[model samples]
Target: MKKIEAFVRHESFDAIRARLADMGLPSMSISEVKGSGRQGGYTESYRGAKTTIFMRPKLKLEMVVNDADVERAVDVILELAHTGEPGDGKIFIIPVEDTVRVRTGERGEIVLASHPDDA
Candidate 1:
């Protein structure tokens, strides 16, 4: 299995989620996160003053998929998340050693197949 972690712009989450749902891979963990990247954070003005937000708000999405589906999931994220600009975010793919379902004590790829509605 592979774990795909993508940090994307806050505004792009809805579209990304919708596309994933359309592909029968809607199961994921999402969180509102803040961090700086290669371009760093930009400056903003308020009350005639300018300030730098070192950490900008972003949406972090994490999904675990079968080894063969890793590229498919990554492609979905890249297609929706790219804005042709900086701070667009990053994606990390990692190996998942195993999985255990708390309720049934299921393990391995079988654990993922338990959800018929998801891929």
Candidate 2:
């Protein structure tokens, strides 16, 4: 199993989610996050004054899937979230040792099956 974590622009969330659904890859957790990458951050202008916005708002999407689905899921996110500019965001894949479904006492692959695509 694998866990795919993607940090994407907040504005691209809707489109990315829709694309994932179309590809039969639903079931994800989304969270609002703030951080800076290689660009370090940017500046904002308000009332003719400039302020340093050190941390930018981003959307974090997390999903656990079978090993076979990792590549496709990563591709879908990358394709849909790209903006051809800095701060477009990044994707990380981590190995998942185990998973459990609390309500039904299911484990491993069985837990993943509860997700839309796995079902």
Q: Which ten contiguous residues of candidate 1 have the minimum total lDDT?
A: 110-119
Candidate 2 stretches with Cα past 4 Å from truth are 114-119
Task: Give the per-residue lDDT digits (tens) of candidate 2, residues 72-105.
Answer: 9898888888989998999999999999788878
lDDT of each: 0.86, 0.86
- Candidate 1 lDDT, 64-107, residue by residue in tens: 98887788889989988999998889999989999888988889
By summed lDDT, the worst window of 10 consecutive residues in model 2 runs over 110-119
What does the lDDT read for residue 99 in candidate 2? 91
What's the true lDDT of residue 37 in model 1? 87
Q: How well does candidate 2 match the true structure in TM-score terms?
A: 0.87
